[model samples]
Target: MQITIKVLKGSDCTLEVAPTSTILEVKQQIETELQISAANQKLLLLGRPLNNEQTIASYPNIKEGTKLNLVVMKPCLRDSIQRGFRKHYPEQQAERLTNEFMTDFEKKLNEQSLDDLERFADSIVSRATT
Candidate 1:
């Protein structure tokens, strides 16, 4: 059977798949065609997320010509910050600092205070400079 996959902010693609194929298998196929990693892919059928272990046949609504939405999850903020730190610090130091920064940043975010968040960000910058 064939189905269409519409990627968010990306192009749509069609694939030939077996009814018994698992969601993970479909993701792998999408990865081959779109270059997006399976771990990052989230397939949705009518706004409901598909389970990795489930087969297409399990979803009675899914059939030939059916369209599935594909959302690609972005990398963690901590990871992006860690990469920036790696340019200036050793790997171990980068990891340690990234973890510490993310912990504090998350706490500040939870507080929902814009002024305090700005101060926290400024402190991070100052610490990085020194």
Candidate 2:
């Protein structure tokens, strides 16, 4: 099955792994793909830290199409701007924009942002359209 890794402020990617794969193995795969160190990766499944020692089967909620969020305490600049070159492709552009929004939302959540989620989302929509 495919597991979707959502980098809080970056584009999401899917990885194919066996159900018995350990969460740590998933992190290792992510580290290889995103160039982020495993030590720096703080993974969450539904807003809770995902234990590295557990197998994917241990978390029933983590089956096919499950989204796991990866929070990088310090984002790498090269990873961000380096991803911008494909702006001409609509699909790539859309993905880049989604990453930008997720990044912002994650930042606010960390700061205990007082803004209403709906309002914040609406602002993003408005800005995107204009």
Candidate 3:
């Protein structure tokens, strides 16, 4: 049976897949349509996790016109920070650049008094308004 897949934060699509088609196969098709890697996609119906190796026929909740949400998994905090910095600064030769920066920044923040932290927040707000 055909089904429409809706991504939580991305584009919606459809697949003309059979009820016997494996979930992994569905993910491959999603990867084709959305360009999101299968590793990052999670197809869910009514909050129940779908098994990658299971066929559509295995799930009674999924059928034609059924809306399955695609949730892209987020990397860990360290990976996110590293990726963010790498995306903006390609020339940085440091391997653990974001980790180093975040460690030092966290240390500084922990060392600051509560009043100083409040002032830091105020400064951020002032900068945004200016």
Candidate 4:
């Protein structure tokens, strides 16, 4: 079966796939066709996000010529921070610091509310300066 994928920022692509194919497999095909990584891709059908483990057959409404929305997630914050640290530190030190920072940052991220996110960002800036 052929389905159309509408990317949020790029051109739409059509893929040939089986009805039994998992969403992950569809993502892999999109990765091959569009050069977008599977990890960063989010597939949606009629505004509902598709589970990577689910199959096309599971969605009874989907058939030939169905259109799925593709949303690409932003790059990892850890990777960006690690790259910045690499400019000033050795590879091993940068890795260690990035890991440590991510561990604490993730904890705070989970605990902080949307209202507290501004304060959290300020604290991160202060920590980075010191």
Candidate 5:
């Protein structure tokens, strides 16, 4: 059997696991993939919490290809802050770089505005000649 998991602060991944695998074992695999502690991760099977000792075979009523969502809840305010930082750091970096580039571009445009039309034409002609 196979299972699909969406981990919080992690990517959506799929694992080709055995039907007899315990919930703990599956969580261990997810921990290895997501690089987070499995102890903090919560596994929900069919909208119900699966105890640490629960096994996949316990839920024989559910069909194969069942979708499972794994969530990692922040235990405290500090953990939430850390997770927020990790999530937004790349976006903040991109925004800063874009602002810098836009500033430089605007400065260049402002400097170009002082040039006369004739100078602009001459520059274009020189480029064509080159």
Candidate 6:
């Protein structure tokens, strides 16, 4: 069976493999073809992370012609532009976009002394209520 592998930072490539292939085996093939490390590879199956040990055949949702997207999070110059790319792809999803929208807020909070953060919040509240 044929499948399309889409690498996030790199280019997409085509592969012909059996449906019974293990997720780890597929990852190895991709790493061999792309010359990327396994640790850096993050595969999203229908927008969800795949377990390293899960087999493609085990997932009833995935079939013979399934398209797998392989995303590599190796830091790049573009990452510098965004300050942190985890915003684009959340390090954790439970927070929603609160982390992304408040990127500057987190940065400021981290940079400020604890007393400064309290004072800043106080000033904002005082001005808003007045």
Model 4 agreement with the true structure over 10-125: per-residue lDDT tens digits:
88999998989999999999999998879889999989999999999999978999999999998688877987999999999999999999999889879888879888788999
TM-score of 6: 0.53
Better of 2 and 6 by lDDT: 2
Q: Write the per-residue lDDT of candidate 3 for residues 11-90, one digit (tens) a residue.
A: 78988889899999999999898888687778898987799999999998888889898898976666657767877676
lDDT of each: 0.94, 0.82, 0.84, 0.92, 0.73, 0.73
Question: For residues 44-67, what per-residue lDDT tens digits would candidate 1 score against the true structure?
Answer: 999999999999999999999999
Better of 2 and 5 by TM-score: 2
Candidates 2 and 3: which is better by TM-score? Answer: 3
User: Against the true structure, what is every candidate's RMSD?
Assistant: 7.0, 12.3, 4.9, 7.1, 14.3, 11.8
Whole-model lDDT, model 2 = 0.82
* lDDT of predicted model 1: 0.94
Of 3 and 6, the candidate ranking higher by lDDT: 3
Q: Estimate each model's TM-score.
A: 0.63, 0.56, 0.58, 0.63, 0.52, 0.53
Which lDDT tens digits does candidate 2 get at residues 4-121?
9999879998999898898889999998999887867888988999888999999989888999999987656534443454454476675776677668867877876456767888
Q: How many backbone overlaps does candidate 3 show?
A: 0
Which lDDT value does model 3 have at 43?
89
Best by lDDT: 1
**What would the per-residue lDDT of candidate 6 be over residues 1-130, giving only the tens digit for each residue?**
7777888765888777666788788788887888775766788888998888877777777765677788887654433434454547554542444445567656776899989879989999999999
Q: Show the lowest summed lDDT stretch of 10 residues, model 3.
A: 87-96
Worst 10 residues of 4 by lDDT: 74-83
